[model samples]
Target: MTATQTKKALLNKIECAYMPVSDPGVSAEWYERVLGLKLRSPVKPGSGAIMIMGGGQWLFLLPSPGMTPLTFETTGWAGEGESFEMFPLCFETDDIAALHASLAESGTWTEAAVRDEGGCGLQLDFKDPDGNKYQAWQPPAQKGE
Candidate 1:
């Protein structure tokens, strides 16, 4: 395929993101309870499961050899210092403050308070049982829509 055709043919949408977890059941339960994600399939002890996060996105909770889950982190535009983040699995919401408040009251593990991202969005960092950080983002409302 030519460059233009290839670019056009390429489906840029991300289907699912693979999240390495110590246990699929545990992670799946956490995602469902904390993030309100629906399980797309039933997962067994050694197997993984697909979760629907709405908007054509999915989370694949796969098993990993390491008992410990990796710490998800990110940095600012400078990209020098590291900050806690679930890089591979950032979630979106329409109302960030409500979500943050709900999660805070839900008794889940919230890593930090919500941050105002200027023109980007509102960000709230949280985590699962294995220290895998996740973020909730609410984009700025469009003007004169």
Candidate 2:
């Protein structure tokens, strides 16, 4: 069998995105600021936030109705690779340098950019106020972009 057919057998594209952001607004903003994705559903009156790419992915960021907002605006043990950290939110950006500049100006105290072991991807690390790690990356859309 060809390599292309092998990949088709094993890999499925991400059908949809489901995330629990302590604050939908903050998560939506971060996705925009870093990944350049416009949130499909803004925080409208009596409506929660749902973000969608123009293509096929939709991420629902459900925040508690009355809970205080939380985002990866702070730093601590979250990005330190602690096993207790659990899941980290990973996003893809078309331009990593631009996103990095924006994050630097954001002044929310984010982690430094790191290159992955793989040749093509770059990661900018940060932890939200809730200590949930969020990383933005670029150049690895299809195994090696």
Candidate 3:
């Protein structure tokens, strides 16, 4: 197969997202109370918190020294000031408006309005207590909807 026509199998879906935070315990509680993420496991001696998304996807919050949230934003596309995205831990949402309102009322959301990416649906970015950035994305509808 040529370089542009290689017939390789596609990789499987993502199993989990590793989030670096200043404190695992505090971040875990914020994710639980604010984002409604249930605690899958407590912080271990050397490990971190494990949270489960709706579709059984795992989110691991590990401790890291001098860890900081990404400064740029994304809608699955390139833009100025955008970084490598080092895994922003995007959560798929069914109701972006409701989620946005809730996060806004909590006074923790980073942005005021959701970005409506024409074909990609809506997205809202927010940060945790430790400044770990995250996103909630609502995928576009399929044809015949």
Name the lDDT of candidate 3. Answer: 0.77
- Clashing residue pairs in candidate 2 are 71-128, 71-129, 72-127, 72-128, 73-128
Report lDDT (CA) for all predictions: 0.75, 0.62, 0.77
Which model scores highest in lDDT? 3
* Candidate 3 lowest-lDDT run of ten: 79-88
What's the distance in Å from true for residue 8, model 3? 2.2
Stretches of candidate 1 off by over 4 Å are: 1-11, 72-86
What's model 3's lDDT at 144? 96
How many residue pairs collide in each prediction?
0, 5, 0
Work out the TM-score per prediction: 0.74, 0.58, 0.76
Scored against the true structure, residue 56 in model 2 reaches a CA lDDT of: 47
lDDT of 1: 0.75
Error at 35, model 2, angstroms:
4.0
- Tens digits of per-residue lDDT for model 3, 12-115: 88889888888888888877777778889767766789988778888888988888764454455555555444335677998888877777777785678989
Per-residue alpha-carbon lDDT of candidate 2 for residues 1-145, written as tens digits (9 for 90 to 100): 7766643456577766556556777767876775456788558644557777646477676766554333434345457654333234676767767777776776654666655637567777665443455667776657553
lDDT of 1 at 20: 80
Off by over 4 Å in 3: 70-87, 141-145
2 or 3, which is superior by TM-score?
3
Q: Considering summed lDDT, which 10 consecutive residues are worst modelled in model 2? A: 67-76
